[model samples]
Target: MKESGRKQGAASPCAACKLLRRRCAQDCVFSPYFPADEPQKFANVHKVFGASNVNKMLQELPMHQRGDAVSSMVYEANARVRDPVYGCVGAISSLQQQIDALQTQLALAQAEVVHLRVRQTASLSNHGFGPGSPNSSGSPSSKLMGSQVKPIFDMDMVVDQASLGESMWSC
Candidate 1:
């Protein structure tokens, strides 16, 4: 038993303990999440959040939550490493801009729908059929014979054309 214990110490330490220059206990908090083979994972986490803090967090959390916590830490660390300043905030801003653009497009589309309905109703009244006439399909109210009523503006195509990056916020 004593010989086995000595051999276990000789075995390679887990990434966390190796990076921190300490022996990895058999029950180390990092051992399950970070293996010895993936040193870079530990290095990234260590750089963003010190080893001691990470260890403490893992220890405090329940076993089921530790995996998700580790994954989140790695993702946040990568984003911070890439941006340094803005980090996740940059991503959120970009998404919000897209949402706003899409909403504006939706409003414009709704207005166009109303305009077509009015034009259809006028044409139908001329032909002795009212707006709610059972003779017509709801879908074709916007179409005048074979002519399709095109949208006044295409929201997605326009948003993609414009670069809503950091420079957009200046104005």
Candidate 2:
């Protein structure tokens, strides 16, 4: 019988061994993670961490943990190759900046909505359909808008609460 066009007992060199130009033993540590088909995985790792360091790291870890260690090493190695100075930290900082900018934009949009609703309430009040007017019950839209807009526009109450050390957006 044969497997992958080689005899059953025959062994093909893994990526590490092939790149290093050496024979792959039956119990080679890199064979499981660095297969022959994905040579670049091992090449980048070898470039950043060196083959000896990878070998030592794998040999120091337990059987189950070695796979995770290899995965982390590959990710860090790839990041290091892409950005040698900052690596993964640069990516994280960029994402955090985007989040902060989006949050600021969201706050501005909410303020605009509140301003529009306040204008609508003032217009209705001028037409005798305001909350306390005799024709308040005649305009269902005005009543609903008045009820919704009051809480957001109560700046004095919000300022008082903030003075009491209560956070509005706290988790």
Candidate 3:
């Protein structure tokens, strides 16, 4: 059966009593529950419990400022990403252009090969070297005879011949 009225000489009130705006019981037991030395710690606790006021203050700030702040951060991130993407796209476009040019060159080369083959066939026909003709160089016997001729002469023989030709010309 403790006293129900407020006690005398109370230093400070409990947090709950302060929040509720009520008279404290002046009990020393609740003092150990909170830090007594630092007033900022108690203030922080009060602010955390009373977050509605803080939120209202933040909401009162201009919308454009918040939007611009967010947009600036996003713009910086986008700028960082853009250079690499642009470089990759440029490289791909360059490779595609090179491939297109190579394809055109290949088509031209193929056309030249076909034209040369036609010309060779026309010349062979005019020379009386049609498929079964005896004078045709395309014959297997002619090819075998060509293959048997050794075109790779010895280096010593080439040097001797070159020297002999030079001496004869000098004389």
lDDT, ranked from best to worst:
2, 1, 3
Please write out the lDDT profile of model 3 over residues 1-171, one tens digit for every residue: 445344655445655355545555654222333324544433453444343443343356565564443344334334434454454456567788887777666656655655555565465566665566676544433443476664332112222334434443341
Instruction: Give the per-residue lDDT of model 1 (tens digit) for 1-171.
Output: 343222365577789988988877777788888888999998988999999899899999999999999999998878788888987788788888898787667666655655655665576667755546665443333433433675342222333212333223333
With a 3 Å backbone cut-off (N, CA, C), the pairs that clash in candidate 1 are none
Residue ranges of candidate 2 with Cα displaced over 4 Å: 1-10, 133-171
Cα error, candidate 1, residue 2 (Å): 11
Which is better, 2 or 3, measured by TM-score? 2
Q: lDDT per model, in order?
A: 0.71, 0.75, 0.46
Count of backbone clashes, every candidate in sequence: 0, 0, 0
Q: Which ten residues in a row have the lowest lDDT in candidate 2?
A: 155-164
List pairs with backbone clashes in candidate 2. none
Model 1 alpha-carbon miss at residue 97, Å:
1.9
Off by over 4 Å in 3: 1-85, 137-171
